[model samples]
Target: MHIFDYSFLDNGLLPAALTNLTANIYALRSASGLRREANPKIFTELEQVARVQSVKSSNAIEGIITSDERIAAIVNQSSAPLNHDEAEIAGYRDALNTIHTNFKDLDFRQADILSLHAQLLAFSGNDDGGKYKQNDNLILEIDSAGKRRIRFRPVPAQETAEAMEQLELAYMEARGNANINQLLLIPCVILDFLCIHPFRDGNGRMSRLLSLLLLYKKGFLAGKYISFEEQINLYQQLYYTALQESSRGWHENTSDYAPFMKNFLSMLYMCYKELDKRFAILHGKKVTKKARIEATLENSLTPLSKRDICAILPDVSPTTVEAVLGAMVKAGKIRRVGQGRATRYIRT
Candidate 1:
């Protein structure tokens, strides 16, 4: 389906969920604009932890096995991968690092995506890295008896390049129209990408990498501070179910995007919520009430009304919350998302 098709937006993604996702996406954007940390060390520490978890969780989803300690060591640059699985894990870490360092400058074009895929599978000695599948591949599900059956058939090998080119063009065209929010559009695009299954291997990991890249490009930075892949891994079965549900009739351009979009948005919301709790734990004791409030507002997954703040911080008075929120709004640390009683505060 092309970007102009109504199915992209009207195809069953819940309206309520879309509204909620929009708010969270905006909140994350505001949080990314946070003042240079009062202490950069804490965030750096968390970033490393998040990176390790992301690498571990993403690789683990592919049945790649290694001790947590070893993964941590590999991520920390203290050790080399010991086996084939660990080597693939290391490749993931390297690809992730490239995304982390260059997401700002990267374009989600065919060559860029292929380059990351190559980087993602660098451990493989053959030349499959960064290349489309040269032959048809089946997505299979193995039964309890170890009998594997095809679950889906993707675009034919010869059509992979043309399919991807059209998909990229569709996305670029959609992006030019401001009415289509990229957050919602991204999940749909990922769903189509998975259904296409353009590459020979590593499609799952590549999808997650693309998720982070798109999130960063859209100005939502929660994936960096909290592991998006980890959150998805926590509910891996649901992840597959959602993808399957959304891709049911994808080849015919008659499927629902809601299932996967719901999962995607839920995963994103979890990341922001986790970021809030982590910040409160790491900085609450050291920072003042106002700073804490600032952190809360910035880290919030949704715009929080004054009553919401009071609810979250009962130890602090309503007056204190009000004053802090007011100050934050004035200083551009946060913005009031609505007017009067309906108003809720979010990062600027």
Candidate 2:
């Protein structure tokens, strides 16, 4: 087997999914134009919201949860951890803050990775933070019956360091070549890292943290305004399925990376799209009764049903809302999604 090789990049072509994803990325990138196009105050507010949601969702995915109010307090540091879960949340907040503040200076090397892990679990009583697995770790899925089955076998503890080195070397070598897209390059490395299961714990959180870092480095600033971790947590099952599918046969270097890549790219696209919608509402845009219905739709990060829009604009008549929605749809400013009562409209 050709371990740690990036022979997959040789084709100089992308698969259909990636090709489509690349096109979407290009369109959104062009739409974004310059960062200055967004209001500074709006961006700052959204960034803070993203931070709180990201830390909360990432921890919640691992079944570590606290009340939304508590999460906010812990994240804002207005309060201390009331329990173990809150303490963990606090640790994540610190690590995420560090990454946000210093990602440009952080290298994607073993030392840095370990350090990030250490910071992630710093408040926890576990002394094993920052250390690689001293024993084999099993990837498992527990059913409702509490039954656990091994999902995949990671690199044994003895080979953990070397495997990590090889994985990073492969990514760095490929990254140096401009022919490969950083978008594709980053996810492949993440898939490999997850499959390797290099750390004893916090692999999932690390993957998400590294995702933010890699995206920022590649100039994908969507995560700064929208919480990608929250998206993944919302679609948690899809995330796990993509990882499981992409990781199959990984040890023999024969795994397909597309599933996870698709999920990653799609989440990124959603983030940007959300950012666009949310941006329209910010920057002191005044709404009138005439534009209230349309503005309400534009203001939401997620698609809104007629009832949803009406609830936000209780003063507006349903007839008026319907008329404006029809005009907007026909004018191509927004389109209908879903069906009937489930129908929602979103800006095109």
Candidate 3:
């Protein structure tokens, strides 16, 4: 005898919000492409390095970061008698690589996405891969005595599958309409998924990957292009805080997702802004070899050698630097002193 209130669907605000979010995403993508076109070599090289680093760091922190040091270390090192870390990292990397390579072809279906989650959790080495929980999970809170206590209980194990199915169905319905903002839909699905606590472990990591996958499917690949996970690492505390805030009293809880949504949007915006700035610096205007070398020397506090210059300016060849240095010496932008490996460049 329960009646559902569908007023939120009729308000028209959700559709409008989604439209604006999609438009902004497109504009950001165009700007990103323009920057890439301007500085293809440097932008591509730095981006790949950054992405790998981000993924590694995020995977390392996993469950250990949230619970206890011993637990964290065990989870991170895969030495806690569980030994699932390697498997988890591999699965996550595979999922990421797949998304990066075939972003456009992603169809956003439930089973396919769940399989990715299963792959991600395969590292947990648990038999629950791609399956819902069979028993109720407890949300634990720590007391002053350092004892763990159950704070909130979830729906029964038998009902877990049904709950997840409903959430997935809602997600599909929302996605199909296209008129609904994908941004709103993203956080909604993420929060609900966490609430379900579908898998036995690796839920947090899977949730994050799912968020990125959804974004890639919708063309917000700019975040991945510049390492959104790195940005999250920088604000790890806030990241967890937002998750905890969203999940508090989640069941029958009139909790507002505004805080979590705000943080998510802010992180996305920051990543795009940083990428934009980097693109501008790389492609804004071309500087001659001499000018570039002089600028590099002046900006760096440490003394630079030929090898260091090569590392910093990967786009410029070693022979090119040697040629540029010879010209610069004649032009007096730098004075090379000493001999062989001992030689160093100082701004004149």
Highest TM-score: give the candidate number.
2
Q: On residues 133-160, what C-alpha lDDT tens digit does candidate 2 reach at each position?
A: 9999998888899999998898999999
Instruction: Tell me the tens digit of each residue's lDDT in model 3 across 275-333.
Output: 66445444533876555665666544234567656655666778988887787788886
**Every candidate's lDDT:** 0.79, 0.81, 0.63
lDDT of 1: 0.79
Worst 10 residues of 1 by lDDT: 1-10
TM values, all candidates? 0.78, 0.83, 0.68
Backbone atom clashes (below 3 Å) for every candidate: 0, 0, 4
Ranking the candidates on TM-score from highest down gives 2, 1, 3
**Best by the lDDT measure:** 2
**lDDT-sorted candidate list, best first:** 2, 1, 3
Model 2 residue runs over 4 Å out of place are: 33-38, 144-146, 288-348
Instruction: Evaluate residue 258 in candidate 3 and report its C-alpha lDDT on the 0 to 100 scale.
Output: 54
Q: Mind giving the per-residue lDDT tens digits that candidate 1 earns over 40-93? A: 755665677679879988998989968666887888789988888888888899
